[model samples]
Target chain A: MKLSNLLSEKRPAILERWFDVVLETYPADTKNFLQKQNNQFANPVGHTIHQGMESILNGLLSGSDLQEFSTPLDNIIRIRAVQDIAASQAVAFILSLKKLIREELEKSQRMDSFIKELSLLEDKIDTLVLMSFDIYMQCREKIYDLKANETKRLTYRLLQRANLVCEVEEPGPQQND
Target chain B: MAKFSAKPKDLAKIRYTPPKTEWTETPVEFREHMFCHSAKPKDLETVGFPYGRAWSAKDDDWKLPDNWEQIILQGMKDLLGKYRSFQLFMDICVRCGACADKCHFFIGSGDPKNMPVLRAELLRSVYRGNFTLAGKILRKLAGARDLTVGVLKEWWYYFYQCTECRRCSVFCPYGIDTAEITMMGRELMNMIGLQLGWIGGPVAACYMKGNHLGLEPHTIKSSIEFFLDDIETLTGIKIEPSFNRKGAEILFVTPSGDLFANPGTYTAMGYLMLFHELGLDYTWSTYASEGGNFGFFTSNEMAKRLNSKIYAEAKRLGVKWILGGECGHMWRVLSQYMDTWNGPADFMEVPKSPITGTVFDNAKSMKMVHIAEFTADLIKHNKLKLDKSRNDHLNVTFHDSCNTSRGMGLLEEPRYIINNVCNHFHEMPENTIREKTFCCGSGTGLNASENMELRMRGGFPRANAVKYVHERYGVNLLANVCAIDRATLSASMDYWVPGVGVAGVHELVGNALIMKGEKERTQDMRLEPLPEKEGSENV
Candidate 1:
């Protein structure tokens, strides 16, 4: 069977197994809330991972363009960027999909015929991993920007107390008295 | 896989060792991605805050008025004269170190500056330099430090780090309220223009639009309507909640976060369902929509400004009394400060629970009753029918919010309602609850996403206690009264306890409420399948 045919047929099993694998990164106790509490707002971190995994799986199976993968890839990476995981560990879930797929195919005894197609899928996932690394870096950078910004804002009064700077009325269109 | 690479050596130790370094020499490290974003200049300016120029916390110079030093000293002098608590707190300190290990931040991060005594001493040191005669002569020998830029930076860092939960006061033999000192510190910071955006932005929004999310009149109506639609779908009951309707006997006020966010929205649905079933004569004002005052975290004047609208709206709507929802600081303001700042509420009568006809003597001054107290009264009278089995799936633990627990003595009311509504109720370690409760770590405007690292560290003690109950009893549900808790504890639970979920006390109330003519309920307010339904499906 072609890889696409195998993937389309085994999508549900692949996604479930992949979700469990991703959830395994969290502590054993946290997995139930991440799995059972399904509301997007109530369990946002859980929702993000679950939805991100599903979208990534669908994108992988369909072999969609890289542009189509941006939303899910960004969602998953952004969440992982803040979590207690190393940068390598953060994007490791992308690579875990390769193993999940291989195991699912092996369960159906189609691994020998699907080898070349699986390699093609692996290459697609490698591209996704790079994209994820970029997203993670961006999230990390944004966090730094916020920290610097907060430090300035929080310290503004202190600077004022020290007589470092003075407030000058800006002559803007909105500044009319 | 274990979440932490390095486990704490001892999670149960409750002792402290003061660091050898002098407090002044101890510099704060600004870790990346661990602080909340700065308030937008436009938002600050709108609220008339002295925010000028684009600035970053990493900047060398913060733009200020030319006479900033004089301004700070004058502000201190003003505060000292006005508040007797400030004067008393400034003058006396035995430093017995009873509160040394009480703070969640100190417990989690092991930072000496986080100690309640040291945290207050940061300000008291400045006071010794400027105010006291001994400090004028003895200076550093008397524990007095000159108000330098470095000291100011230390103040900003540590004060923001405090949730102002007043955990320290309970242990203080002198009964010095560190939260009072923190409020004064934040107010003094506002004197120079150092205000957090997470706090200032909501203050601005709440000032202009009557809610923190900045939802306008129509938006508030539509938001409530959206919850009504969800309630209708879940229970087959359509609740008609009146907004700004006059001639109602009572005015209902809740945290706008409830009208805007999840878990909170479900709690809001509980309010509507309970009210609709009782046919209670109540009105919600979109104009005075928000109950939680971020301004209280800013300054007393700003707090009073925001609080004025609540009573102003109540008077305008001609309601006999006000009914407050499950919020923390809002109650602190209502119970402690609101009457003093914006009251005489002479136009209103003492709040009487219409169901039980119990006059709320505790709230006689403000004429506002807490929803928990109101619900507890109903349950006491057996007015509303509750199906405790509906919530049997949850092993519930009630987290006593700091303000509600300390400020109002509202300890028994929430627990009474929770015990009546849920079958399995567990309490966290006694030291970590009731009047001795730990903060959610993200209260008092520290709930911003950028401060996740700081919040998690501060949340560790509370989460540690929750983990104790969770591991022992399989307690999955964490219930509380504060809207900020509803918003922030989810993240804390995700980080620390993992599978444990956070809910408002009322969200559980909504789940257990048996309506007049509802569907065979298969889902809770989150639309998650009910445990019984799941069991039936399996069968």
Candidate 2:
């Protein structure tokens, strides 16, 4: 219809403006629970996860406090799995492997350049997680599109059915004749 | 420097507290007695639209049969048209409920669907169902449904309920105009021959004649002459007003109601006297003289058709510019629709009030200037001798019409004139003032004699505010600048808000008028300080 509408379908909205909403709103209250309950994360894995979370947080909080006010849902644990996603699923798989690797290193109390090694792994994990999220979000949007189409199909079918039933169930003048 | 535009004030402070004063008042509930749109919708039987009122299709003139498929498609197509704001509204109206409380009708009547967005949903839901592929297949899930007789009735009821005051537009994030949608919906309803009797009658009257009040050429001329005589008696300035002056510098178009009726006739005289005093060239056209458009009443074609006369008259006159009178909806129609078909004319220049010699380029092409601005300009430039003390005894409150205030961004011009002309000036309140102003308990041409209940609702908030000032500050005069608002307030005075006398901003100017003779006399009890004109140039 309008020119801008056609372009909008091809281009994405300026969502980066609202990206920080995910960080500040994402439940800072859950930090102690995540750190204390899981200890394979203790020295090495914990440091890697924290580094990944920090990197994600840094990318998310910049624009408007008004945006945060409108959208209050900030906690995201399930989205951690969403973030580990990558174009090459191998990167995601490799990023997840660092959690266990760091835990193993910490159990052995390996201190030489331990923090430095873990930081690099955590950064890689963060990249993989972001890429995976991008991929997953695109997929989810497509899936909703499909769901919407299916909903339309059902509604049309229902309307047709209702129309037919009304025509048959109710009398017309010719039929009365 | 950028032209002066008041940035919207932060709306952090609106309270339910009433003004504490002992005086005549009506409870808010009694005044808010109006009903609209069927909420919590439900389809009775094999109705095509969900939640549609069950009705057998009939060929009767009143209750048209269900043409759900066609209507839904049409509504969808109209909404998805080339208009950018219309399209934006379709996509971005997240139904955030931010605009829920912004509707004057909603607040006054306590009707949820009267809320601007909810009223929109009546048509929008159908648009989604019929047009969008997803909605066609899954209408129920998306909350989209077909349009039926019941939905059609609700559309008429609620859409008409909206005066299109644009109170909702202020709160919309995308700056989408619901008035646009309301206009479209009204147009659609008329196409189906489903308009209210009162609105339909006026539209018919307007189409049959050149004016809404059905003033034949002779009648229109006589009304002007009679008003000129009234002007003579009131201000002692007398000269026969010439008509159909082809080469006149300006064609002063006013609503026929004013020319034919009381109080309004006097305001028309004020403009004439000001023009006469300033030695300005102006002519009034009997053909295009009527400014209030009934096309705004029922249909856009009708609105367009009524408005077309102005440009047509301007072409007929070959005049340099056109100036609108003190009518309400007339300016709204001009602001929104005049440029759409009859574009910027090559002949007429941008409006320059010859009285004050002020160039109103801001109100040039698509813009409009209320009479207050012209007079304010005159007084500011020392063009007219003003008798400010003539209004000394009257404690006046300015009633800003929804059209003049919210529609055209006019707030200061009237007060500017009144402050100079009157003694004591006051405002209504904070949030309920200016662009966020309340309706005059009746406007949108729905000020019908039969629809008492709805009229009562529309005027509730306005009456309450007037009652508030009348009680607390002892302000009895409601001095609004719009003619229709003045008329509506007069009708609602004893019925809605008691003990309030409504006058045009010009009438206040007239009251303090220092005529050509008879001054320095406190003969009348009003204690009018006579005319102050000594060296002011006479037209």
Candidate 3:
């Protein structure tokens, strides 16, 4: 049987394990709350991770040609970026997928024909890990960009008051179009 | 932590480590995205703010005028002479550390800078260095330090971290308010063009467009029309709310967050539904649309300028009194600052709730009544019919917004309204509620998405208390009156206490309100599936 078919067959168990592993990174105090929360709106971080991981897993296993794989990757990493964890720890969850898949493949007892296919899958996991890194760094950079933008805004008036800069005119307010 | 003989003997029993930093030489790091965005050259220019220019916070050079220090020192001298609070607060702090552990930021992050006493000391140190004899003579010995570019950066970093929640004031032996000190720091920062975007953008928007989010006249009408459509769908009642209609009995004002953001918009819907049911005479002005003043976060003069529109619109529309919607800092400004800045408002009469006929004597001075006070009175008079079982699905917890709890002492009215509307209501830990309430963490214009880490830290204690109730009693809905709370608590709850959603107090009121000629309700304000709609759902 193909590795894709095997992955499809064990999708729920694989996804559940991945979810548990990702959730384990949070502090013990908040980990239990995230685990027990079932409401989608109320626990959006968990829901996003749950939904995002499912999409990512389906996409990865189906071997469908897809653009914007990092979109779902973003959902998982953005929350982690703002979390207290370091950058490496934030992206470590992506690598866990590889371990889970390897375990599942070993349990199926098909080590010969699928060997090359398994290597190909492992390479894809490496690429995903790279993409996760880029996304995490971008999230961090975006945070700094916001801070810079806010500081500039906070002091704009002061600059004008001191005659240090020139004023630019704003477009007039529009009534209902 | 600084071990000092000056530390109060009674306050020494506290467990938290005092934040010890080298006041003279500590250089602030901007790596953390906790600061607000810089004001755009155009937004600042449009509002006639001084020094409107393109400057980068990331750049090493801030492009200050040659005499920036003199400018700041002059501003300080001017403020000290004008406001007695500024002068007294600057002079009186003994570093008792009473206000240290009380701050949510300190409690969550353990950053000594977040400690209320230390947060104030950021500016107080500067005051001592520049103005006091002890600071000039003793220098570091007096805890005073020269104001350098690095010290200016430190001021910008630490002041913005404070939500100006005033929780520390409740514990201070000297009655020192950190919020006042923070305001002074931010005001001084503004003179040097170090404003944060979360704050300055709204101030600019509110100044020019007459509302934050820069909603033009047409967008305001369209947004209300959308809510009207939702009101008709939910209650089978069409609400034709007047926009800027003259001679209305009262002019309705709320934060523009309610007009634009989720959860807050739901509360706006509740107001429309209740007003429609009672046939109350009121009109919403596109001009005075904003109730929450971002200027209050920046400085006193700008806050006063933003607040002027409220009474101006009231007088122009010939309304008798103003009915304010569910907002936290809006109440703080209205209750404490608005009258002093813009009053006697003798043009307006004391607000009498049209539905309940209960005169709001507490608000007689300002002629503005809080929506909770008005709604609680309606419930007391038994004016509107309610179905508490409609909200049976949500186990609710009340988050007292910092401004309302501490600024105005509006402790019971919201709870009174919530208890009447929802059967399951839980108070957070006693220490974290009422006047001792933790801020939503992102208040005072710190609710930007980029600062989620800072907000989560600030919001942690509030969320921790929420987690306690959530685990113990299964509370799923967190309700508060402030628009900033509605906007921010969503993120905090998602992080610390996931599965506990934030809502405006009125959203729940709308859920339980049974209209006189309504269809059988099947959804809450957000149009989610109502409990009875779930065929096999448990009660």
By DockQ, the best candidate is 3
- By TM-score, the better pick of 1 and 2 is 1
> What tens digits encode model 2's per-residue C-alpha lDDT throughout B253-351?
877666534445556666666666666687888788678886686555557776777888888888888777787777777876788756766557878
Q: Write the residue-wise lDDT of candidate 3 on B390-435 in tens digits.
A: 8889999999999999999999999999999988899887788999
Cα lDDT listed for each candidate: 0.81, 0.58, 0.80
- Identify the candidate with maximal lDDT: 1
CAPRI-wise, candidate 3 is incorrect
Model 1 Cα lDDT, one tens digit per residue, B29-134: 5554455665677877887877545665666666656787788889999999999999999988799878876777665554567889989999999999999999
Error of 3 at B199 (Å): 1.9
Q: Across the candidates, what are chain A's individual TM-scores?
A: 0.83, 0.30, 0.87
Task: Estimate how well candidate 1 is docked, as a DockQ score.
Answer: 0.02
Report residue B166 deviation for candidate 3 (angstroms). Answer: 0.4
Report the C-alpha lDDT of model 3 over A77-117, residue by residue, as the tens digit: 76667654557667777888989988887888776768898
DockQ-based CAPRI category assigned to the predicted complex of candidate 2: incorrect
**Share of native interface contacts recovered by each model:** 0.01, 0.00, 0.03
lDDT comparing candidate 1 with the true structure: 0.81
In candidate 2 the C-alpha lDDT for residue B494 amounts to 44
